[model samples]
Target: MSSGNSRGRGTGRNQGTGRKQEPQKRESILEYQKYENKMIRVKFHGGREVQGVLKGHDNLMNLVLDDTVELMRDPSDLNVITEKKRNLGLVVCRGTQIIVISPVEGMKEIPNPFQQ
Candidate 1:
């Protein structure tokens, strides 16, 4: 009865693997300074949309928006927007889960371009 297995004491995991965990070198879209104090709309995944004044943004794409208004979607159709809306004043948006970010200025509903 050996007290402990001689070859099982040390758990060798990723020991000889030359894979060095490196941080992501992805560059930020940046240029958020110009959008500060300007109205912008951010559409997130899962069909969530919000509009607010750009207050501040960091290198990580995290946004500090003021006077944020979350646009409510139709229950029947997720792509449709209802007249109802909710105000989420002063919100911090995550860099991830952001699908689209556009300026509210000069923005209008356009017909589907895929239509023949």
Candidate 2:
């Protein structure tokens, strides 16, 4: 009876530990996959940004931006990027590119501004 109890406790702890690790791998794969289906916002250096679905990526990872963008949900405000903001456009090159792929939930709301 004593040996059986110890085995049961060991099994229970192992099961709990296994459960936690399983989701993390699944979550990362889902994150990468989100770029394929959903619309993404790509921000470039020199203070330029574009909102569009990521259609393709080159060997150099330069993005091809389309003229017509399907804006699913506004990130903050519709007019977050104003006329005063400079260098804001599409077709980001290799050197000055910052691609932010949208998450599966559309736009993941975080406690504070952070990137994964």
What TM-score does candidate 1 reach?
Answer: 0.72
Question: Per-residue lDDT of 1-116 in model 2, one digit per residue for the tens?
Answer: 36355444446544656554333332222233336535566555544455654555554456554442433333476524544432333444462356454433457545645534
Report the lDDT tens digits of candidate 1 across residue range 1-116.
Answer: 97766576353554457565567687666677778899999999898999999998877778889999999999999989899999999999998878888999989988889977
Over 4 Å off, model 2: 1-34, 67-95, 99-105, 108-116
lDDT of each: 0.87, 0.47
**Highest TM-score scorer:** 1
Query: Could you tell me the lDDT of residue 78 within candidate 2?
Result: 51
lDDT of 1: 0.87
Candidate 1 off by > 4 Å: 1-27
| Model 1, backbone clash pairs (residues 3+ apart or across chains), number | 0
Supply candidate 2's per-residue lDDT for 101: 43
lDDT, candidate 1, at 95: 81
